[model samples]
Target: MTTSSRLADTPLAGELIRGALEIESTGRGLLPHRLPAWARAQCADGQLHMAESQPSGVRLVFRTRATVVELDTIPTKRVYAGAPPRPDGVYELLVDGRPAGRGSVPGGDTLHLDAATGTAARRPGPAGTLRFGGLPDRMKDVEVWLPHDETTELVALRADAHVEPAPEPDRPVWLHHGSSISHGSNATVPTGIWPARAARLGGVELVNLGFGGGALLDPFTARTIRDTAADLISVKIGVNLVNADLMRSRAFGPAVHGFLDTIRDGHPTTPLLVVSPLYCPIHEDTPGPAAFDLEALAAGEVRFTATGKPDERASGKLTLNVIREELARLVARRAADDPNLHHLDGRRLYGEDDFAELPLPDGLHLDAAAHRRVGERFAALALTGAGPLAARGRRRV
Candidate 1:
């Protein structure tokens, strides 16, 4: 395999970027997790544990000019043993604020999940390497965005030239939490996720807490957001709750209140916006445990279908419709005293009309083009003039 020669052969453990929490040192290299040790200790669910290790916004930032770059990593890639094969997660490389390269590693450890049984098996595998050559001969700022979906443990960073940490940009930090949509389930690349895209367009830094299948109104998640330092904060709710069938209308409302209450405990006056879920057609009027559309899979694509009956709503089961209504009411009630708190209908970002134009390819999560549209709309709708984010900037800074 090609490797950097001019740069020292030894791995640079001391020279890592600052986006991750604590980097766990391993015999092989470094594992970057979004969750700190304390927060991780509170959850027993395997899904949440796995999601925390995905490193949604983590990256390696530095300056180098070796004309060749190599990043070695061992990613815990998820695989459905019987389901269709998934594409390898991608890493994004940016040089001097310009797109430099994009590619995926060849192989890594795999978690083979059984679609029918809801069980998984860990299969050990070898580390894979990604290399980029022909970089400009002069030193420039470089950022290597980690994969959004896979659990990546960075093994080594090598470039033929010297590297140093890039200077911190004077930009607002946005801490956001949501479900799989925000976790970038269908996004094409790491930075291609809507939150990442929105952060770039809004000229802000991002701390994404978009846990896939794991944004289930967990108190620990709220506490994590409370502890993180950020200038702007948002929480996107609904789809995950409804789709997982994890809670009912009665519980979801109070759960949300408690979640926001914890965040407010830490960020008393931070401009906090509560966003509802995106336009997911299956769960809009119907309740869920959304099931895989086997028919679609048989037809050679993946999609989701709602399984809960509409009558289940009478028992307080949540649907996207119920969630939006409750969220609006809850926010309005709280906003009477909490002027810093605001609400945005998730549909506003991706509405019915938009769905008519560009349906969610999987019947649930937004596809690549949809991600771009939602991200651009979010920047315009939530970060522009008179928006809550803008208003906060005026008040705080």
Candidate 2:
């Protein structure tokens, strides 16, 4: 047998990864996980399992002078059973914090899911390479951002020169958790995702906990956040709860309190901001358990619509409006004693005006342009002068 012509023997270490909490060695390569193994072990839900492995905000960061780079990866691309095929996941390259190039590995694996039946099938494929050439020859920091929505298994990293972990930045760390919107639904590129964009504009290091369809207020998730080290923390709540129809008003308040309590156990005084959900007309007053728009799916487009009735509110069924009011009250009451705590109405980031101009194409997640607008708004509102997330003693100069 002839020897294969690939150089991937060196094992990947945690130091090269930025946003992931854990790295697992697989037969193929190293897989980054946003949640710890303990937390992942506690979950049996396939959605959560898949979301945590997607590496939404994770990137391989290093210092190198290589003019050419190659990454061997196995990306598990997703597809709705009847909907049009999704595009391959994109890997973005950044040189010294500036956009340099973008590429995608041709093939790896396919995950076919039936939304109506809530079933999924996985098919394995071969690993592919992502190559970037003609990079600057001078030594500089290099970052390879993994696809935000795809499950990517990194087999090996190859460069023309020596590679080492990039020095940790002195910026404050911003840890954020939310739903698919924050996880980067519909945002074409990884860096275009609102959180990534916001992290850049805000001049902060990001550890994103956003998980698609898996952001329910779970104790294990809260515990994960509690154990993590963050200088500034924010949890965007509401949309996922409403869409899943996971809890009624009665349970939501206590659950929110419990979630915050768990985090406070670890960080008693770190600046904590609780943000509500952005505006979605379908769920504004209507409760959910949102359903796919079958007609749209049949027409080769994926869309979502609320199924719960508006009248359910009388029975403590939660809606976006109900969630906002409750969150506002909870923050106000708690902020009195906890001076560092604050609340942001999510609509402030993307509201009616934004909706009119840039509608959510899938009726739930923001498109690429909307994500950029939201990130800019967030940077201006929370990361600038005297804002809720303003770095202590550092103001916009």
TM-score quality measure for candidate 1: 0.95
lDDT of 1 by residue, 169-277 (tens): 7778888889888888888998889988888888777888888888888888888888888888889988989889998877888899999999998899888999988
Across residues 1-397, which tens digit of lDDT does each residue of candidate 2 receive? 1123433333468899899999888888899999999999998999999998998899999998888888889999898778888888899999999999999887899898987789999999989988888999899999999999999999878877788888988888899999999999999999999999999999998999999998899999999999998888899999999999999999999999999999999888888899999999999999999988999987878889999999999999999999999999998998999998999999999999999999999999999999999999888889767788878842211
Q: What lDDT is reached at residue 69 by model 2?
A: 81
lDDT of each prediction vs. the true structure? 0.84, 0.90
* Model 2: residue 292 alpha-carbon error in angstroms: 0.4
- List the RMSD of every prediction in angstroms: 1.9, 2.7
